[model samples]
Target: MSSSTELTEKKVFLLKSLDGVIFEVEESVAVQLEVIRELIEGDCARPFISLYNVTSEILALVIEYCKHHAETCSGGTSATIADEDLKTFDNEFMNVDENILLELCSAADYLDIKSLFELTCRTLASLIKDRTIIEVRKMFNVENDFSVVEEKAVRKEFAWAFK
Candidate 1:
């Protein structure tokens, strides 16, 4: 409990992504992910929380989001970063390609980062909205893996919704 010892134990944690990349993250940023927060609260947080399902690229993006949010919400930067500014940041953060967006969505879900998950989902939904099935597939670079007949049948089943 010495002041020097307390100062040495900085409020930070570590996360290892699926690609074996290790990230040193502040506790404020780490808490943005519900799963990480749970681990900390349960006293089960290790020196490094291994995210076996998240890639380094997506994890980096998630960390950036958490860091920004953590700083803004801590009231330390609210005077400079308002909620509207956060919304703008979220909008721009989701402007990546479909593949990256998909990865972000999956990572957000795995990390239980609610805001990020919702933002990615909304970005995905908006991409498909008011677009034809073919356009939607093209936008997502989705190959028709299904056989021709199967594709026709499934498309027919939900034909009304598409129209």
Candidate 2:
């Protein structure tokens, strides 16, 4: 029942990152973030969405990812694209340094991008799999809070699994 003009109208949203950088993104892309979708659904008239905890660098990466997902799932001929292509895109999307990956993970979690959050977490887990706690601590710059005795006790308990 809507007129063609209404259907043809585009919806864009302005998002402000932690560093005061603003990005103009399409509604389709914004909706991919559950937090943003809730905000938009709650008030479509709201012009600006602010992500206070997300740095501009991480926010930019998230925006790029959401836009790619939105376009890939746009429900047209491209919707029938091969799954392998999507996998390739995902692989390439996750190719980044550890710091950027961690930042992206935090951004994804804050934005409630389930797919992105899971992907980033999985990528991080992969990096730590089979590595020693010392290596993990070094990689993530985590301080060893456990004393030598506690560390040895826990390691002794899990010695069977460490083989």
Question: Model 2 misses residue 70 by how many Å?
Answer: 0.6
Model 2: runs farther than 4 Å from truth?
1-7, 78-82
Tens digits of per-residue lDDT, candidate 1, 48-108, equal 8999999888899999998988767766555555687788888888889888998898888
Q: TM-score, each model?
A: 0.79, 0.89
- Name the 10 consecutive residues with the lowest summed lDDT in model 2: 75-84
TM-score winner: 2
What would the per-residue lDDT of candidate 2 be over residues 91-146, giving only the tens digit for each residue?
99999999899989988898899999999999999988989878999889989989
For each candidate, the alpha-carbon lDDT, in order, equals: 0.85, 0.85
Q: After superposition, how far is residue 155 of candidate 2 from its true place, in Å?
A: 0.7
